[model samples]
Target: MVDHMIILLRSISAFVILLIITRFLGKQTLSNMNFHEFVTAVILGAIAANFAFNEKMQVIHLLISLAVFTFTSYLLSIIIVKNRKFRMWTEGTPTILIEGGKILEDNLKKNHLTLDTLNQMLRQKDIFDYSEIEYALLEINGKISVMKKKEYHNVTLKDLKKGSKDLGNFPIELIMDGQLLEGNLKVNNIPPEWVMDKLTARGKQLDDVFYAVKGSNGQLYIDFYNDKITHPIDIE
Candidate 1:
């Protein structure tokens, strides 16, 4: 067995050294790491991992290596921050993935993102399809920013310019734990038959659906057989 005591001691040493080095590296290293800085980070991780188990290697050696890496990264970060041209070249700007109600297929390919992958990211922000999205930006941090269609969003009295309903439009639960919701069906002027038809059209089994909700505008959202989910299907 690997020596637990050695691992514990080495881990403690690594943590202390890494903390000091990271502090010296500054906030930009974590928040906005450029290509060269990122490469240096990977090298640092490799160096840290290799020395973390070397019983003969003193912790000071690791600390020294970390210090050098941190100094380089910190210097680069300041250079990038001060120079707009350098920043643009280093981190790159956010790419418009979807523009003017259409998917930029060239941009999508440039970013090596498939339509399915983009849709999955969009759904993370409660956006499901291209039809519902107006603008999509792939940020430098590798995160997606999405803007929904105007009709899909909540319409305040100011937006409508009239007092339509003397109430608030609340998101209603249409299905929970694989059960068809009669209450929400009645609320949305939708029959249970419509729910069954929608699910059938999608070719998704109700039992296979992990989440389903009817949002403010009576838009039905259903997630079918998501492997990432950990919960067992509730078949009531």
Candidate 2:
């Protein structure tokens, strides 16, 4: 029981330390963490786990190790930010895989990307036909950025030479889980009476709504708690 208590306490301590280090490293460490940053995080996690659960390992020694690794990574981040050449060396430049609707086989070979993989990536970007791509770049983080040809690109009102009007902000949630969000309604200038009228028209009360939002198109999108769809297609 004592041993378990020790492990629990150590685990909590390690978690707190790691959380502080992560916050110090900033949000980018999680959001846009490159290859090196990712490896550093993995290593730190392993070290923390070892000291937390493994009684054989000295807690002080592991803490010191974690501190050193985190400090080194933080210092390297600073250097990378200040030095352009260092940044390029650490995080390789984006490679152009496709140009002018033509596949660069040499570049693909260099990146070790197979035609099948390329096609899969293209399909992810909603491009089934490679011929429709104007440019496709393999980013430093291994994600593919694609640009479709003018003909294949999505058309907007501006493309049709139509004057653009303010379409309000994106859907603001006025209600969620049958709870009214008066603050959101006030911020969005949505009156409660307008919401009630809409709900009444659909024969739904506020309590019946599981989720509700005021869309940018000036429409109320409401999902009911009892709502059911027989054939739910999986898009993802």
TM-score of each: 0.59, 0.66
Model 2 bad stretches (over 4 Å): 162-236
**Which portions of model 1 miss their true places by more than 4 Å?**
1-7, 27-37, 56-61, 156-236
Best by TM-score: 2
Estimate the Cα RMSD of every predicted model relative to the unseen true structure. 18.5, 15.3
TM-score: model 2 vs. ground truth: 0.66
CA-lDDT, candidates in order: 0.74, 0.84
Tens-place lDDT digits, model 2, residues 1-236: 99999999999998999999998888878787787799889999999899789999998899889999999999999987766568879998888899878999999999999999999988888889888877889999888998766666666878579744445244477777676878778987878888889899999899898888886456778999886887879754
Q: How far is candidate 1 from the true structure (C-alpha RMSD, Å)?
A: 18.5
Worst 10 residues of 2 by lDDT: 163-172
